[model samples]
Target: MGSVLVIGSFNVDHVWTSDRLPRPGETLSGRYSSGPGGKGFNQAVAARRAGAATRFVCALGGDGGGDLARALAADDGIDLRELRSEAPTGTAGIYLDEAGGNSIVIGAGANADLSAAFVTAQAGAFAEAAVVLTQLESPAAAVLEGLRRARAAGAVALLNPAPANAAVAADLLAATDILTPNETEFTGLLARSTGTRVADDAIAATPDDRLHDWCRALLPHGIVVITLGGAGCFVSHADDARRGEEAACYRLPAAPARVVDTTGAGDAFNGALAAGLTQAPAAPFAQHVRLATHYAALSTERAGAAAAMPSAAQLRERFGELFSAG
Candidate 1:
């Protein structure tokens, strides 16, 4: 087992809990609260709480949001490596409806200022990590640099291309050892990478074999894991040098939980997967995904992003039956 490293962004999230999502030109009032968030930050916290020795790297501003990130990282016991910039700290406005669905708008701020050079300076972290995880919340240059360095170091490079509305570079996709995306992000990636428009939810209800075929078409190499909410996750393993047909596919059932806020469930899955990889590197790959899936389900039972992550004790207590160690 080895360490997990997360290179991403940290933002303070402002949230509104409403009865329903407001449509265009409609204004609605709801309960308001602010907390720690940012896909990178949330994932780092999740990894730490999932029982791994985790490190987080990101750029934070000098404002109150930055200070808040620092304090939260300390409390979570996550090894945080942050670069300081002149810009204000990043932020996100999240709207959560009664059904636990959410819509978000991000303000990059200092997150946009994170440079490739900064990531390069911390090359040793990527080199020493067993798993190096990154997302699109930070600058593209920085994300690519981190992934390249991680791959060069022979570490498992995991890429989660979130906020699917943006275009991801080919080099980044090609370098990834593992790709995790939701339905929207998968469709967006295929459209951007190969000009193939696979309709949204085209294979959401299909069998693992079908999902594997689609993932193979999208990425001939590397591992692909797509989260399909309550239907669970589809994982295709094409990392072996054998033919694509030899690749194995797995479907892990989603854990049952009382839903509250789904804002951070994906981050929880990514983080817990990274952590689980470190905790049991020699175990079957599906083992890691199962632990992560259960952890993510529990995350939705809570309300806030980072706040929703279960502690190591809580995860084991609640989802221990699914843990490989059990």
Candidate 2:
């Protein structure tokens, strides 16, 4: 197993808890709390906790939020040397409804200011990694550039396309080794400005129809992993060089747990998957997928994003059965 590198964003998440989500133009009072988040930070913590040598390459503003972000990274034992300081740290205003659902509005702030040069400067760090993880929080060009370098260095590149954006390049998708997206994001990426919405629950219950189509379309480019949230996830790989219909598909059920805040759950899955790949590079793909599911389930057992992440021992203790079976 080798090191894991994450290039993404860092943000301080402000969470408000309420009985129900407010409608448009509506105001509601709720309890508020602050914690460490951002897809990059959460995933780096997840990978480190899963017993991987993990480092984070991200940009932060020299503000109060940046202080907390650095402290959180230190606490998780994630290497912060590659982390850059620019504008103020980013923030997200989050609202959590009674059923554990959430709505978030992000202020990119310094996250949007991350430049291609910053990514290029960190090429040496990426070259030393066995797996490189990225997301859509940072500039698309920077993320793609990092992927290109990682590929040239013989590292497996895993990309999570989130917070739906239309600027993603097709060439970047082709360069990715693994592409993970939730049901909503999957629809948004394909529809591209059509405003089409796919209910999360519907995707989980009947993923074969809609998700299969989406996965098939991307098989020509690379592997696709569509997350169905509680119903687990779907994996698709190209069938053969001659025939596209040779695409193979599989689904894994989510590990059972007492539901809490779901922030960073997908990031947890991706990070764990990357770590599992390093630990068991020669193992069957299903084994690695199962390990990721277990890691993600343990993350939702607590509150907050980075705070809820569990160490390798905790995950093995709670989810040893699943891994043993695998």
Candidate 3:
């Protein structure tokens, strides 16, 4: 089986679960917890549990935070390619509410030092990948190099542009085969690509045809998946069979989940989606999306980032029909 390569970050997540999120200048008391997380690390764990043969590449500091990352990856049976650096390991501050909502802030640390040269040195990994997954937590040059390497090797390249406010290079966007973004990131990407102000509500409210039109203008040869919390996800893929302006679009309903903390739901979806794509290369794109959505729903039932990912056995036991049926 060709491996799914995840090029991203590794961070220690500090979490506070409270009745409600804190407001400006207000310090609220809440339960506290800490664990390993980072978009790259979280997604890699999700993919591994989703039953994909996976490898993860990231920069790490020579510290206890990095030690935790190594330990977790080892337990998950992941192939970890670590690049040690002088900076401290990255970290995230998370606040979770009783309503399953979350707010987070990140300290980039070693994640910011994933140089393009390092990615280029890992050429063999990219060449052997069936799918290449990345997020914006790492440096831009490194992210761009990873996408380029994946595309050059004919592997499916998926970009989950998170931290919504970051600006992505045009070349990086052009190299992407699949772009997964939450509502906020969607708005940001569109605004940057079109040089016009984009409102998040307008995107959620637009009809399918209009959305496809925007997708075509943004990426002519790729797919765009916009994940809406409760309304489910909207997918638009470029159709080669059609001429000038045409694409396929669909809206799937949200999967049932007993909500806990929604901290890593998006990472779960992207990882599971990548796993499904790698495992069933011939299956319809919609089927992968559905499986990913269901996988994400299951993830939210638990309360941590990487720790919340459900294993293949759990998925089979709970969602038997999901994988066994057509």
Error of 1 at 22 (Å): 0.6
- Model 2 spans > 4 angstroms off: 82-86, 193-202, 205-210, 240-247, 321-326
CA shift at 214, candidate 1, in angstroms? 2.4
Q: What tens digits encode model 3's per-residue C-alpha lDDT throughout 1-326?
A: 67789999999999999999999999998999999899999999999999898999999999999999999999999999988999999999999999999999999999999999998888888878989999999999989999999989889989999879888878989889999988889878877897656688777788889877777777788888999888899888888512122338889889888999898999999999889888887777888888888889899999999999998778778777666323
Give model 2's TM-score versus the native structure.
0.90
* Residue 130 CA displacement from its true place in model 1, Å: 0.5
Best by lDDT: 3
Poorest lDDT segment (10 consecutive residues) of candidate 3: 239-248
Alpha carbon lDDT at 67, candidate 2: 85
In model 1, the clashing pairs are: none
Tell me the lDDT of model 1 at 117. Answer: 95
Tell me the deviation in Å of residue 215 in model 2: 1.1
Off by over 4 Å in 1: 239-247, 324-326
- Using TM-score as the yardstick, the better of models 1 and 2 is 1
Estimate candidate 2's RMSD in Å.
3.2
